[model samples]
Target chain A: MSEDRIDIGGIADEYVLGLLDAIEARQVETDMESDPDLKAAIAASRDRFLPLDDTAEPTVIGDDLWTRIDAALPVQGAAPIDVSRLTANDNRPGGWRATALAAMAAAVILAVALSVNLMRTIEPLVVAVLVNEAGDIQAIVEDFGNEKAAVRLLADFTVPQGKTIEVWTLPSPERGPVSLGLIDDARSVRLDGPALPKPHDSQLYELTLEQAGGSPTGRPTGLILAKGFAKITR
Target chain B: MVTGAAPDDLTTALAACAKGDRTALRGIFDREAGRLVTIAERIVRRRDLAEEVVQESFIRIWTQAHQYQPDRGSARGWIYAIVRNRALNLLRDSKREYTVEDVELLRERDQVDHVMAAWHRLDRTSRLHDCLGALDDTKRRGILMAYIGGYSHGEIAGRLSIPLGTTKSWIRRGLSALRECMA
Candidate 1:
């Protein structure tokens, strides 16, 4: 990254052209503060195509588009979640609250190696976009609850690093994946049937290289540092 | 310093938004919805996905406006960044159809009206567009596709049908030239 080898001039061009590498783009961002010249260049290049932004024709979206969106919105005027009756204790957890709690429990298991592989002998199981590092989502973690996981994971573990595992119980492993939560690093973790089922019966629990924020995919589209089964807890 | 509203005006609006002012939020939305949608559509070509990206972007903006630190960047850049990042993710994560699909995208003849309207705005768009105009037509188009269409380097290359390396070089050099020119 020496100034000599790292050509700010070249990078600026690529960046404006939107063809710069991740590392190069990041470098430009860092250098921009001290390098006034670089900043000016970026602004100019950005302008070149700013107007083409609305290049697409005005899509005559069927009423359903807005209606669907409106319907999906958090009914802003819808009862306001009955806040009056909701005391700290009576706070009815949203559906996700339970899953988040379940994830925490799963995380705890990940921390301490107590494989629930045996649980697969029991009932069935279940499954956001995420970025790689550029702050964009790489994949999604599908949720499966009502379907009662139709799949199972049947594998043992042995990772190099105490890898953090994330289990994705996707509706269709063929499609995108869902992130249930994280598992402890280089350790064994199990999911129960009453628990979340892995996306496919042969769902994947992979160890990804993540910073604190976790992978954007909600699943590990990162280096498959290690992988194992979607076993159940007997 | 003199206009309908100063730069500070945008910041003030954001502050109000941060205070949970739904009205202020709407104002921000009203002002930027078209732009946001355009930006979102740029990144996520699919209209449905683009709309989703725009909606999510607004939700994030509403919730995260309080996190805005003008010192880092302007309210506008930060806002656009959110949508940009979201759109980028949508494009990369979800395998979208790269080619023109549906009659809507291919029915290009009619889109000229919309495109022209945007073009007229661009021609008149403040000092920024002037800076962009300084770039060569090819370089400008490449940059525009990226910024507006949300086309990745690869996509840009595909559309432009040029060597990937050349496209990358154009973007890099274009940015540098722009910064220099604008400065």
Candidate 2:
């Protein structure tokens, strides 16, 4: 770590504070990213200043705050951006933005539809929900590696900040929900069961939002988000 | 819905946003808005302009979320860079050139900024006040301006009415001193 022997500790401090010129600043950023030891040192120095940014404690983002933010946010799922705000400034050439966004949205929608459609058609391993009046949804999974099948469902509720939703595969109608790892929005984690259970009625794939990181006690702390029947649509 | 993408799931979530997952996009916003807004406010120092920066950052994130790769820095760092760059440009554009009066105002504002900044989680300075108190007045001020306010060497020189080279050395030595003392 002779490369780390430079007594330029002061320069690292200056760099973190944005005291360096653009060139020097970029150089430091590059070094920080490329050099792990240097990065660790800078982080140690920078930690001294962390409290400066910690003014707002992790306050419970109000329920209403989410609503307000949601109202202000762009609509989801390939929805075309509503760029009505830019139009009022008829002074500058802002029309290009909306046009560009519309083009992008069009492209993405085409991609998603293709993916969703293909997934449906291929029907690799299918699962369907048979939800009923009692608010129960049984997950019918089909075609795992062999005759085995796995069932999974994402809960349709808040997972709370720093928490994950666990999808449980109940062995029998009266049995407890089996553990399926935490659900992150990264990708749908489809939990596979052992051998295919006799495809019967009322086999549920349920999800409950648990506490920070996840339910420590192996149970739901937040609330049930989604419950669906594993109706494997071949 | 969130506006910005999550750090760990940037690429996937960005892909999802492109796929029209409004909820996914909103998830990004809900996570990082507060930090981004603070960065914007620090750069612009004006509410409306900071808002403009935040709005622009959101729009840019909406479009560029697709290009974000996990191998790069981080979702948070990337979004912050975008927001900070926007805020800086906006600050530069509005011709808010720091004048003598602005300097005085900035100095007065530093106390409150210093107080509130210490409350933040950025970790620029931890136990800094104690380290600062240990230093001489000149060295303490140097650390304060550089770390607390993110001031450039030239600006610090101008504020203290000292030669640029001298200010630079002070900052360099002061940081070293603080490190030694803290260690």
Candidate 3:
């Protein structure tokens, strides 16, 4: 890294200490990605200054704040299947029978509605939920057999005034993630599938906040707001 | 009194959060939300904006929990880093007018001194405490004002009535010395 000629340790310390200006901080972030030494220095400085956090007095959180945060979480089934909840299904008490029955009824109705309305044209073999850094489900991807994938937004997302959200995929075993395309909003869009391998189970799909148009480098060149792995349901 | 989860527990809770356990996240929130809000408030200087920063920080924590590597630092530190980064980003983006009346500026300096004194009382034994204690008042306050208050170099210089370059140099030198002393 060209920054090697500079004092990375001092820069990392200042960056972690929040002394760098916004523009300088952003530059450091960009540099850290390619400069392993700079990244390590940053990690070290973070640990060094960590104890100072103990100084702040705890300010009581408003009761409604958690409620707001909870509401923003990506709804279940929008991403990879949660592996932890999969086990211990048969051990629930008999009191859960009523809840189970109601859930099953709702699932059946929803399945029929989805098949009739959203999936009528293309059968989804694998579904992936793409979440932003906030864990908000920003988009959902349905892989129809072949290299084609249909992506739909789960929430109304406004592309920041001057920026666009770029989609990327890290196909299994690939050394680098490849760009899918640029999305303007939370609207359904078809990805014609880049020249990379077909989308497969366990592959990661991510949405990054990037400058308008897209990453000029043909790669993700911004903050990743959400990402999740593909899970084959069929 | 704010009682944090032990570093190990926080790490485990974050790991569980990465697994999509909402309750684990709530457990973390129940523990650190107050301290996080207070820190954000110190930086952003508005209760509502601080709350917004805390809310957004938790969401970022939940989504990026899987990316937290324990070997690098404490989970609590990682969480605070995210919160501080979010708060600072908001402060920078808002570009709020920084017109401080003379009286208001004096009041803020006193407030910072009060908080710094409180910190000294609570954390007397930490290596950072010792290293920071060793610095002169200007260097120490410059570093604290930047890290704790999220003041930019210009802001710190303005607050301290010093040249901007001097403020920057003091903070950089302070951090470098702190690192060396702690090491």
Candidate 4:
């Protein structure tokens, strides 16, 4: 390998080893976005030192700690929905109610389709109902074992002029978001999962409106239209 | 090292967590919280703050479970990495004033004798124990102090009475050697 590659790998090693100071660590994280090689090197280094995690002595924790953490979690059902409050005293005839009724009908059809699809697959599979801010299902991601996955859009979405929708996943917060690919159409699209890591439940799948081709910065650079967490269906 | 959740189990639980399964999150907490608390306490040196770190780290783990990649590393490592980073950030951000005596005490407590005792307790057949055994005392101790104790280069240098540059090189080279040996 070239000296330049070795140098990058060495720095990645230090970063993974926690030898880098805060400033250097932050720089590596920024570089990782625009630099795939750097990201791979860091991943390799992380794997190298993984065994070291065994060295820490197991300590007992206070019984209340788990409760405290559980209490602080964002309610899973906290998806943006204000229709309930609005429905309470709406004298207006069929305003939000009409839209909501249509949405619910769509959801029921999608659920039935999903259940049928789930029955056909023998392998352990995970799925995510990607929802917009208003809690409308925009897309559904079905991940089969290994790195194979498919994304199906549930609602009609027109990519704004001079823009395209891109898919991204957050594997871990520290690692930041990794681009999955650009969505060409809203129908069922096969995701290039092998190029990315395996999909895990609670993993987030999001669609962001980016420049026509994609985000030039390698990170999401536009408004996130929809996001949701994957869950195991098996 | 003895792990509560096997790698596959941890990975499965994390996946379930991503699916918003509180049961899966509870499973992980039940299995790993004790060890995580210990790891954080070692770095932060306070039980209460360490517990807080565990709390925050678990929440992150629950919220971000989908992000764990088996290809990158073991699920246990990924989980512990979050806890360690959170504790280290808290310690560094707070800029806790450590008296000279406290530093000396930590250094003394992390001496080779103590570290070796911990190392020997690990399964002797494990690759980590064998590879770590191959390193010279200074290199081994330097790496261990950084990972387990969360000691910065400056602190490691102070403890070892070595120049900062030498200490840095030792750790960097030590890790490189470990990578090669483990591979």
Largest DockQ belongs to which candidate? Answer: 3
Over A1-234, each residue of candidate 2 has an lDDT whose tens digit, in order, gives: 443444546666665666655556557766766776666566555544444434433323324334433434444333343343332221122222223323333433333333344345444333434221122332223333343433333224444577675655554422334555555652354444445445433244455556556666554333444444333333
Off by over 4 Å in 4: A77-234, B96-116
lDDT of 1: 0.47
Determine the C-alpha RMSD for candidate 2 after optimal superposition of all C-alphas. 21.8
Which residue ranges in model 2 land beyond 4 Å of their true spot? Answer: A1-8, A30-34, A38-46, A56-234, B1-28, B56-126, B180-183
What would the per-residue lDDT of candidate 1 be over residues B78-101, giving only the tens digit for each residue? 566666656665454333222233
Instruction: State the local distance difference test value for candidate 3.
Output: 0.68
lDDT of 2 by residue, B1-183 (tens): 122333467556667776667667677767766666665666555443355466556656665566555443445555665665465444333222233454345345644455345433334344555676677777667666555444557767876788999988888778877777777
Angstrom error of the Cα, residue A29, model 2: value is: 3.7
Ranking by DockQ: 3, 4, 1, 2
Per residue, candidate 3 scores C-alpha lDDT tens digits across A73-134 of: 65433445542332122111111122233343334333334434667766776666665432
Please state how well chain A of candidate 1 matches the true chain A, as a TM-score: 0.34
lDDT of 1 by residue, A97-140 (tens): 22333343444344222223323344333122222211212222
Instruction: Name every residue pair that clashes in candidate 4.
Output: A171-B67, A172-B67, A201-B18, A202-B18, A202-B19
Query: Candidate 4 residues A1-234, lDDT tens each?
Result: 677777887888777666787778778867876887887787777655555556566676645567567755655435445434332312112212223334444564465467457446544366666776445778876666465567777788877688888887765443456777778655567666435556665565677777788778777756666766666564
Task: Pull out the clashing pairs in model 3.
Answer: A78-A129, A79-A129, A131-A226, A132-A225, A132-A226, A133-A225
- Best lDDT goes to which candidate? 3
DockQ of each: 0.15, 0.12, 0.20, 0.16
Looking at model 4, give its docking quality level: incorrect
Error of 2 at A67 (Å): 11
Cα error, candidate 2, residue A81 (Å): 20
